[model samples]
Target chain A: MNEGTTVLITGATGFIGGRLVEMLAGRARVRALVSAYTRTSRIARYPVEMVRGDIRDEAAVAQAARGVDVIFHCAYGSRGTPEEKRAITVGGTKNVIAAARASGARLVHLSTQMVYGTPEKGVITEELPRQEGGGTYAESKVEAENLVEAAAAAGLPATILQPTAVYGPWAPVWTVGVLARMREGKVPLVNGGEGACNAVYIDDVIQAMLLAARREGALGERFLVSAREPVSWRDFYGSYEEMLGFPATVPVRVEEAVEPQRRGRRWALPQLLELAREEPSVRSRLGNTFEGQLARRLAGPLFRRRSTPSRTPELDKLRRLRSKPELPVYRLSPTDASFYASTARVEIGKAQRLLGYEPGYDLRAGMELTGEWARWARLVPAKAEEQQAQQKRKGVEAQ
Target chain B: MMVGAGRAAESLHLPAAAMTAQVTTSVIADRNLERAREVARNYGVEQAVAGAEEGKAFADAAILALPHHLHARVARELLEAGLHVLVEKPLALTAAECAELGTIASERRLVLEVGMVRRRFPALRFVKRALERELLGGIRRVTLEEGMPFAWEVTSDFTFRRETGGGVLADSGIHVLDLLAWWFGELEPVAYSDDDMGGVEAEVQFTLRLPSGAPVEVELSRTRELRNSIIIEGERGSLEAGLAFGGALRLDIGEAPLLIGQAQPHASEAGGDYQNVRELFIEQLENFRDSIRGTSSPLVDASEAMVAVGLLERLRAMREPLELPWVTANTTRAA
Candidate 1:
């Protein structure tokens, strides 16, 4: 496609989509298709031609898609009201693909790295299976991506760009909001976050999107676009500490973290018992019958004749533990904890090597820029609230 | 040079209402001509107001922005001259001196206002409103911590010398002491200790009883890092406002949203100490203007200002550098 080729983009008012419009505006005849709700004066100030319409509106999509050779479908929802996420990330994608097909335009569908389910190794490539039993947002993205893959297989000229945690100008998530909270001592790292999260600056993602558009080989394939390295949660937060000229309070450990959970469980037990007693069966003899029914059904299956014939003692012990209330079980592995516990880091080497990606901003520089904004806003202290509060707390604690 | 003045004039532009007719002007009366002229130029008053004969004609009101010892003499002169007076506080070095001004103001029926600009902060107003509404029900105790870093670090002529009423208690703690008196009424005498470090009183910790016998503690320090915070602990919640580095007031009421009082921005980032202190000075000026017009009494009047002066004099006498300190009772009751 030529630089002046008419390119219609859905989700153009969103974080990634907004940046994509700005990046692609000078290079092409950009027509942004934004939902009526997300439209603003900020979008109007930009050079791109903004068409007031939702992606779910077929007629609106068709009108936007008319005469456009390339459709950059860069919209998705992460943090929004539930109704918004449903209308945008799920129904929005369906509308975009339909529009693209109607105009016979090539589609570059922007997906997320989140669809790749929790992995044992923190290294997630395009080949990883989708996470099972993810809630509405994740499940919807998985279904949407599956549709895109099917469309590509059916010979539609389509490409998928799954970028990891994107940061820079116009980033909605993991932007200055999270940084501001962290600077104010509001966000504390909980659960030992061993999971690696990959970040790509907006400039790099734009470059990746352009490269995907020009290359014929990228069609009918998926690419992971992110910063070359994954930052661990400790080092991720240390960037803020470096900016503020303060030493990091030692990383909170898992056992210490679990202490709060244990306390919460103890506090909740009384409330749970009150709930149990208020039930109709609990106040009658039916409570005994309920316990008897539970034991008859559960005990016989565990004490099966074949249980003694189990080959592995570990499996036998596992079965015993399943029946026992006192035995403890660890449902999450360290690697899984890393993915769900702290922050997840992605490895974007494939995108870097294959897609020719290079990020413009580093984590330290980004954090310094973010800190400058925070200081100007007076969202956090300029110099000494922390130090003063520390001394006061120490004095009070000593007393 | 002219352009800089033009810009400064534009930057200093107050609303039309802020500029009232100069009904009562100051005979600023400083031997230091440069400082006096600077104050005059900033406030847009004439320079002859400082001279003795022309002083009374200009002195509808006298502003004693002089050292603590000089306040009583200046006040007595102005009061005798039949000019309403506003003085920078510790209204005088002694209770006797404070009472002299108080008696004169009472006799003349002229307003004698003391400049305590902390009360002008929006956060403090928010706190006072909350207290009135009983949001934090029946405020029982207050903890005040005040300091001026200059007292500890600098050996300057004004602050380091004790004869000028240069102790940390007089310079900074007086503000907190007066605020405590205003915040929790009917201050009953109680136990206190003074930690005198070197040339002046380095720190003083006082325990007082409210009229209702609620215990209030105040710790005044010149030794450590600078901070000014008053935590008003009420029956239901508490409010904390302080002179943060940026001169901010941070308010907290249990799990409720924290309302902060910050210096109104002049331009850009509202840079550094001069701007913050200058704004506070302007607030006091406005309040003084209001008091003269009978719109409202200036927040810190002579009576309240004298309480701080009285407390400081008693404190200076008691500063024996105690070895061990402890309070007998730490309890709060309904007011």
Candidate 2:
């Protein structure tokens, strides 16, 4: 794509979509289609044009698509029950496609790897069929991907990019859930658990999309963008612990089917299915089949069955990512603490080879050195005390 | 006798016939029983309530508004007499004296209250509520500057003397220190040092350690020309409140620097000091009444006030200017 080609973007005010606008601003003529609800700040500095309208509105989407060469349709969620997800992700996609077709624009749809559900063994690829999954978030994304496939069949040039676990500076999930919790010493690891997850930094995900956008061969195809190396949940936690100069405590485990667990089952597929069933409108769409069928079909029969000790061997084979642990030291003792450089390992090779991508910033260095905050205000004694507590726990566990 | 009675009736601001109807009265009770009747008549109370013997039978509730030195003895007597009591600030001359009074009130099941008027101050209450909501986001540091002129210290007796809870600390310092302890619970004295005006602390500066390791600095003096203010610096914002000038409070809720230079006006028509103090005293009285009725507990109960007294005692002792060990609640070994 050249500078003259206008790329129309929906959900441009969102975390991922905002970054995409910045990434494509200097490269292409960017037209950001932001919904009225998500429009927060007035765009002043970016080399982009803004169009404020709801994606659910067909005329508004058509207006946003005028004279655009590429449509990056990322809008989802209408703030309602299970039925809303179908309307927004499925119905919204159809409307977006019609607008894109009217303007003769190629589409790049943001898809998730969660559609594959929990993978059985080796890395799941783009060619793998969508398996049963949990919640409205997954079901809707799968449905949206189908709409894009249908659009491609109807001669609207479209491509799908499925990125797993995007994390960086303004990353919404990892920052709040993992990093913040790690800092506060409240992280929990499940079972004796090792669940391997592949994550790419947000910068790489944006790069991958840019590469796919320009490549003529990417049309009508789906691609998986990740860091290539997989990190187990156990070792991912360990890296955060290493950064804090402490060994984090293993969280206490309770029966998964206990009442306490049942009461607070946020994001559980069964609960979402129950909620979906109570609403008559949603049940009608699913043909009034008995409650739990939608959850069973989406989450698969294998997931519905109890996970047993038979899967333990397969889980154990996954390697925990190695991180440089805190060097044990007292004030008088000589220590190797100075020798350690804090870093998170990422596999940049796949991105480099496939997309001809080069990461502009040293992500680790950028993390260590940022805007103006006095580090001296956070005294070493306070940090050391926290580290000592973590080390003591680890010692007990080892014994 | 009839002429004298008529003159008294005219002076009382009531018709002669309805004089026995609800009497609009004011009362003043010091230790001297001889002056009680005279003071009560002058102030329009139908009868004088005394801290000493014999005068207790005539009053509903005795206002033991005596000097700091007389508070414990007089308050205990009033409580023993089965009448509720309102004592002056510092509650008593010593922390031990305060405890003794508290015990007497408990034994008699009578209402006893201290007059710490600043709790009812609009600015202070606003600051307190903001802290509770964490709107200021974990108070990283706090500073309190409170002082008054020597002219305002009209009494030369117990108020100016160190032995009678009359020093700058016991008199004026309690207000700011209590404010600090209430704003951030469980503060340990990190550092404290002060100057003496002929054996009384005329000036004091101290640093306190909050549970979060944040610093709370207090600067109090008796020589400065009447100033009372508190400034708090939070993670994302700052709050400033002043009591000496117009009783006006302003809060800036954003990252806009220290803003230390903002000056507030000293307006004379703002309000009267006694009116404010009287209202707070009424509030304290009602709270005590409610506690006795089992409807509500006293706001600044004995336990809470005892902690403040402990902090004040430590601050006063720290005035001698010595390198003190960090004496926290858990660190009795260090002590």
Each prediction's DockQ against the real complex = 0.01, 0.01
* Model 2 lDDT tens row, B106-206: 88777676656677665566667778888777666777777654434131244544555566677777767777778778989978876442334555778
Residue pairs clashing in model 2 are A132-A298, A133-A298
Query: What would you estimate as the lDDT of candidate 1?
Result: 0.59
Give the alpha carbon lDDT tens digit for every residue of B190-284 in model 1.
76666433234545677777776666777765533434776777766677766442445565677788776564432123222334444655556
CA displacement after TM-score superposition, residue B12 of candidate 2 (Å):
51
* Residues A1-399 of candidate 2: C-alpha lDDT, one tens digit per residue: 667889998878665786676556556788877654213221212445667677878998999899998898777764688897678887788889999899998888888776765444455666678865446777888988988988888787888878777665344565334555544433434332244546665666676777767676777777776765656655555544545555542422222211222344563657644643454322222221222244446766654353233334442332111211121111100111110111222334544555565543232422232100101112112245556986785455323
Q: Please provide, for model 1 over A151-192, each residue's C-alpha lDDT reduced to its tens digit, 9 standing for 90 to 100.
A: 889888888888877775435566555454444332223343
Residue-level lDDT for B132 in candidate 2: 87
lDDT of each: 0.59, 0.57
Q: Which stretches of candidate 2 lie over 4 Å from their true place?
A: A37-39, A42-45, A179-185, A191-193, A239-399, B1-335
Taking all chains together, each candidate's TM-score versus the true structure is 0.42, 0.41
> Candidate 1: where are CA atoms >4 Å away?
A37-39, A78-84, A183-186, A190-195, A242-250, A255-345, A368-399, B1-335
